[model samples]
Target: MIDSQSNNNHFISESGYLSSILRAPVYEVVQITPLQKMEKISLRFNNIILAKREDMQPVHSFKLRGAYSMISQLSIEEKKRGIVTASAGNHGQGVAFSAKKLGIKSLIVMPVVTTKIKIDAVHRMGGETYLFGSNFDESNKKAIEIAKKNNYIFIPPFDHPSIIAGQGTIAMELLQQDAHIDRIFVPVGGGGLVAGIIVFIKQLMPHIQVIGVEAEDSACLKAALLKGKPVSLSCVGLFAEGVAVKKIGLETFRLCKKYLDDIITVNNDSICSAIKDLFEDVRAISEPSGALALAGMKKYICKKKIKGEKLAHIVSGANVNFHSLRYISERCELGEKQEILLAVMIPEKKGSFLDFCKKIGKKIITELSYRYFHKENACILIGISLANRLNEKKKIIDNLIINKYKVIDLSKDEMAKLHIRYMIGGYPSKNILERLFSFEFPESPLALLKFLKNVSTYWNISLFHYRNYGTDYGRVLTAFHTTKNSPKFEECLNNLGYRFHEETNNPAFCFFLKK
Candidate 1:
C-alpha cells in the first residue's frame, strides 16, 4: 500500500494512487477542466481575470466533478448497490446523473418545498426522488436513514474526502491555467468547494491566497472561523438558496480551517447585483449563490486596494428557475431586496390610499400589489423599493411613521411575509377564504403553470381603496402594463367579452370593461 495523502511526495509515495485520488481508498479524482481567460475583467490594475466555467459540466454544475469522482472510487460492491443522497436540488441531480452515466441505480432525497423546476431537472436527469422533510436538515436525516436501511452508499453533497478531493480539481485546473494567480474566490456552502480548493492550492503553493465567499445571511464559514469552532446557526435566511447552509461539515471545516486564507460575506442585494452583472456583461445566468464569489472578488479587491492581481472566480452553476428570473429582474436593480408587507386600516373617507402611495411612491415604486374587499376597511400588501441611501429610505418610512399607515418593513423580516402579510384581512375574511396565494406571470404564458403556486390564478388584479366612497357604486379599479406587447392580453380580454373604458381608451379597462 502507498501513502496517498496530499503534500508528501517525499519517500515511497504511491506515485499512481497519490496522483489520482480515484485509486485512493476514500477519495475521488476529477480531471481539471480548462480555464477561460476573461480579458475584460483583466484590464484592471494589470490583473488577469480568469473564470472557471464549472457550469458546463454534464450536470450543469461543478457538483458533477465531485459526484462522479467520488462514486467512481467507491468500493465495487458499493457501486453495484448504487448510491443515494440528499439535496435541495443541485447535488442530488449531480449524483443521480453520475450514477446513471455509470450504469447504477440512484436515489435523491429533497425537501418537499423545493421548486418544481429543480425537481423536474432531477427527474429528467434520471434520479428517483423522495420528497421528504420541510427543509434540508430533515432531508439529510432521511437520506442517512435510507442509506443505512437499504445498505446503499450515502453520497453526501459535500463533507467527505472523495467529494472534497474531486472539488479540488478546480484548483488544479486554476493553477495550470494561471500558476502565478494571486487569489481565487470560491462560493461557500458546506465549505467543501472552498476547502478543497484551499487544500490543493496550499499543498502546491502556500503563498497564494484563497478566499471563501458566502451570502451574508448564511455565512457559516465566517461564523465558524470567527468563533474558532463550527457552530450551527439557529436560523438561516435563503436569498442565496444555493449557499444558504446554516452548518458547516466536519471534514470541510477542518480542511478550510487549515488552508483557507479568508472568507467574505456579501449582502443579498450585492449578490443579486452581481448576478445582474453576469447576465448583462457576460450573457450568463448565475444563481445568487454562484454569483457570490464574483461579487466578493469585486468587493475584496476594491476594499483591499489591491491592484495588478490575478483573480480567479469560480462560476459555479446556473440551474436557477425561470420564474426566479422575475425576482432577479425586479430586484437586480433593487439588489433583489425590498421591505415588503401588507397593511390595513379603516377608511377615513377621501383620497387616503393615494395619500399613502403619494407619500411612499413619490420617491420609490419598485412593485405595488394589493387587492380590496368591500367593507369599512381595506387591506393591501406591497414591496417597497428602498433607496440605495439608507438615510433617505428611512426618511420615507419616517414619513409613514408619522402619518400612521401601519407600515411594516418585511425586507428584514420573513416571518411577516410568510404569515402576517396574508393575515391583512379581518379574521372573518382571512379565515373564511379557502386560500390566498400570490405568484407572478412568467415571461410567457407557460410561466403561470410553471411558477404559479397553484394552477388557479386570479387575473392581474391591482385593487386599492381610497378614502372617497361613491354613493351609487364603488369605483372598481385595476392596473395593467400595456405597450407594444400588451395585445395578447387585450385579445384575451376581447375574447372574454370585456372591453376597456372608452374614455380611458388604449386598453385601460376596469371591471366588466367599464360597462
Candidate 2:
C-alpha cells in the first residue's frame, strides 16, 4: 500500500497534476457519466461488473473532458490564435465540440480512413476537418505542420499535462461512485486515460488494482513498457480506430509504466464479443475501443480464475460506424466461443451430406459452403453453433475422424475466416504454379483501383477476392501465377508498401482453391 500523505505530497510537489485535475473546469461542458452495474455480465462472470459510462458524454466519448480541460486553460492570445489537433476520430470530435463551445476556431486533421460518422460529427461541431495520411501517426505529423504554419496552438490528444489531468477526473468520479471497487480496467491507446487513472487510483486507493487493456494489433502501451520507452509501431490495426495509436505518449508512458499493475491485450474478436455483451446488458452500441476494457477484464478473470470480485471497466465511447456492425456481429459468436468453423473433407456421393448431418446431430449448422471439385471427395466449409466450444468442437472433430473423414479446424484461421469461406470454388482447369497471398491496404475511395493497377500490371492474377467489412483497412486475398523462385515478384511486393502475407501453403487454400 502507498503512504497516502507522502505519495500525495510527492505528486503535488513534483507536477501538481493532482491539483490540476482537482481544479479542472471540465464540468463546464463534460458530463459526470454514470457508473452502471452490468447485471448479465456480472452473473456470467460471477463478479460485480461495473462500467463507467463515458459513452454518455456530449461527444459520446470521454475525450471531451481532456480536450475541454486543456483548451479552457489556454491564454486569451492562444485562444484567439485558435487550435489544431490530430485524431483518429473520437478525439477530433471531442476537440471540435469543445472549441465550438468556447467560440474558437479548430482544425482537426484525421486519417483518410476515419469513419464517415466521425468526420460528419466534427463538421457538425463546427470544426474544420482535413483528411490526411492513413493513420494517426501520419496525421499527427500533418497537424503539427498545420499548427506551425497557421501560428495556432497545437493541442495534443493525450501527451500534455493538462490532458492527463483532465482524464484523471474520471478516476475522482469513479472512487466517489464506488469506494468498494477492487479493480479498475482501463483501455490504453496513447496511454492518457490509463495513465491518468493509474496515478490517481494508486495514490488514493493503493490496494485497488489498475490494469490497462490494449488491442493486440495496436498495443503501443504494452510495447512501450516492454521496451522501457515509447516506441512507434511499424503498423497498427485499424479495427479499433479510436485507439489505434502507433506510439504511446512520453509523459503518459512514464506514469503508466511506474503505477500500472498489469497490461492485457485482446484481439478484435474478443472486442467484438465485448461489444455484444455491452449491447445486451446495457443496450448501448459501443465502438470496438470502448468495449476494449471489458474484453480484457473478461480475459483477466478467466486467466486468474477469480470470482466474486468487484471489477469495473471504462466504456470509453460509443461513436460506432453503423456499417461496422456487420463485422462485429459476424465475429462476436466466434469471440464468445459460441460457434466454431471447420473444413471437413467428405466423400462426394449421395447420402454423404445426410450422414454428415446425422453425425452433427442436434448441433445447429450456421453456415455451409461447398463446391463441386472431383467425384471422389469434396471440401466443405461449415459453421456450427455450440454451447461448450472446446469439448463440442473436439467431439465433432473426433466423430468426423472416426468416420474416416479428414477434418481441419479453421476456427482460428484468419484467411479462412476472411476469404476462403466465401471463395469455395473449383480449381483452375490447367495446372499452373499459383502462389496465394493476403494483403491489407488502407481503405479509401481509390484504394482498390490502385491495388488492382499495381498488382495486375506485373503478375497474372489467377485468383482475387476483396471485401469491405467497414474497417479502416480492406482485406484482399489474391493469387498470382508465378514460379517458386520469382525473386522479381517478391521484390515488387516489397516496393508495394502494403502489409501482406504469403498463404500459398495454407491448408484452407490447398483444400478449397488449389489446382
Candidate 3:
C-alpha cells in the first residue's frame, strides 16, 4: 500500500502524490481563495505580511478542497456504497457539501459538544449527523464502527492521500500568488493543512520556511514531532475547539516530521490578539484556530527581530459562533499587553477610594469592582489600560507602589485572569460564622444584587463571588455569616426562592475558605 512513508526520499514534485494533487477534481466544489496582503499587520511587523483567505470558500473553510478531492476520486462502487466520517466542524461540512453534490449518502459522527452552529451547517449541506462522545477521537471511533458494519467507505479526515493532495492545492495557489514568500505559517490540527502545504512547498520552492503553529493547549503536532510518533494527549484546550484533537493522524504526522521546518505554540491570548489583528488589517474576523498561524508568526518575528521579509499565514476558517466574540474581545487587549489586571487594597473608609483613583491618574480603567463589608481594609479588582509600550505597565505599577497602594500584578497570571479575578473575596479573616451557599439564580439585572441585598440585611455577607457562564441561570458561590440567624434569614431565602445548596461541610470550601 502507498503511504507518505514510501515517499521518504523523493521530493513531493517527483512523488506520485504530487501528480494526484495536480489532477485533483476539487475545482467543481472548491474556490481558489485569494492571497491578499495585510497592510496594517505588515507595517506592525516591518514585513510584507499576507493572509491566504481559506475562510472565503463556500463552506467558509479549506476542508471542502480535501473532502471533494477525496470523494471525487473514489471508485463508482465505493460511491454507491456511501461514505462515513467524523469531524469537529469544518471537515463535516466539507464532506456533507461534497456528498450532496456527488449524489452520495454520507453519515457524519460529531462530538456531542460540537457547536450547534456547526452541526446545523452540516445538516444544511445534506449530511446525516450523529452526536456521540465528547471529542473527535470518540466520534471518529463511532464513525469507523458504522462504516465497517454497513460496508461503507470510511473517509479519514486527514490521514489519506486524496485529502492531503486536496489540501495541498492551497500551497499551489500560494506559490502562484506570491513566489517570493519568506515563510508560510500554517495552523496544525490533525495536521492535514500543514502537511499538504509542506508537501507542495518543499518540492518546488524549498527555500521558503514552513512553520507549524498550534494552540499551546493542544499541540499534538509538536508533541508527535518531539517523540518521533503520535501520542494521545490526556486533555486538550477547548478555547480553539476547531484544532483540539487528542492525537495527530499517522500519515499527517509522518509527512510533517519529514517536511516541516519548525513548529511553534502560542497561548490563547496570543490567538485572541491575532483575531483582533485580522479584523484591523482585513476587516475580517477569524475563528481562534484560523488566527493561530498569524499569532505564531508574530511571536517568531518579535523574538527573532526578523525584518523586511514576506510572510504568509493560512487563515483557516471563519466559523466562529457569535456568542464567543465577547470572550475573544475581552482577552485580546490582555494578549496585546494593552491591559493589565491588578488587585489593589485601600482603606474601607470615605475618601480612600477617591485617593486610590487619584493615584491611578488619567489612565483609563477597563474594569473595577468593590463591595464594602464594614472591614478596616478592602480589596478591589481593577483593569488598567495602557498605551501599547512595554514599559507603560511597569511605570504605572511603580507609581502605585510608591504611593503605598498595596497591589498584586495579575497580568501574567492565567488562573488569576480566568477564574480568580471573578472570585475576588479571597480568604476571609473574620471570626463570624459562615455558611457557604451555591445558588443557581436567574441571570438578569439586579437578580444577584437583590439576592445579596436581602441576605445582607439579616446577616453580614462574609463572602460573595459570581461569574456568568453564558447560561440562562447564573451560578453564585457565596457565604453568609449565619452566627446570629434571626427570623429574617429564613424570610430572605423564601423571598428569593432560587435553587441553592448549602455547603457548610464541603471539603473544598473547608480547605480553601473556612477560617
- What alpha-carbon RMSD in Å does predicted model 1 have with respect to the real structure? 13.6
* Model 1: worst 10 consecutive residues (lDDT sum): 465-474
Candidate 3: which stretches are off by over 4 Å? Answer: 1-14, 423-515
What is the lDDT, from 0 to 100, of the residue 122 in candidate 2? 97
Q: What lDDT is reached at residue 26 by model 3?
A: 89
Candidate 3: tens digits of C-alpha lDDT, residues 1-515: 22321213233333766777778888998888999899988887899999999999999999999899888877778889998999988899999999999999999998875667888999999999998865788899999899889988888888777788899999999988889999999999988899889988898889999999999989998888788899988777677877888889887888889889998899989999999999998988898999999999999998879999999999999988777787789889999889998877788888999999998899999998776644787778899999965799989889989998887787776545655566544567656678777776654566768886778766877776676543234557777877653666666787786766676675444423455
Quote each prediction's TM-score: 0.65, 0.96, 0.83
Q: Number of the top candidate by TM-score?
A: 2
Number of clashing pairs, model 3?
A: 0
Compare the candidates by lDDT and give the number of the best one. Answer: 2
Name the lDDT value of residue 67 in candidate 1.
78
Q: What lDDT does model 1 reach?
A: 0.64
lDDT of 1 by residue, 1-515 (tens): 32212222223222232254434322232335546666655674356767788776766678877777677766667778878889986788888778777788999998766777777888888889998875687899999899889988888777766677667777777776879888899999998788778777776788999998988878888888888888898656555667768899877887788778888878766777778777765677877777888889877877788877778899888777665665556445545334333343425446877877777755555445444555554445565555453365567657777877655454543223323333343333222112122221112224234322222143333222211111111122223323334435544443332112222331111111222
Q: Candidate 3 — worst ten consecutive residues by lDDT sum?
A: 1-10
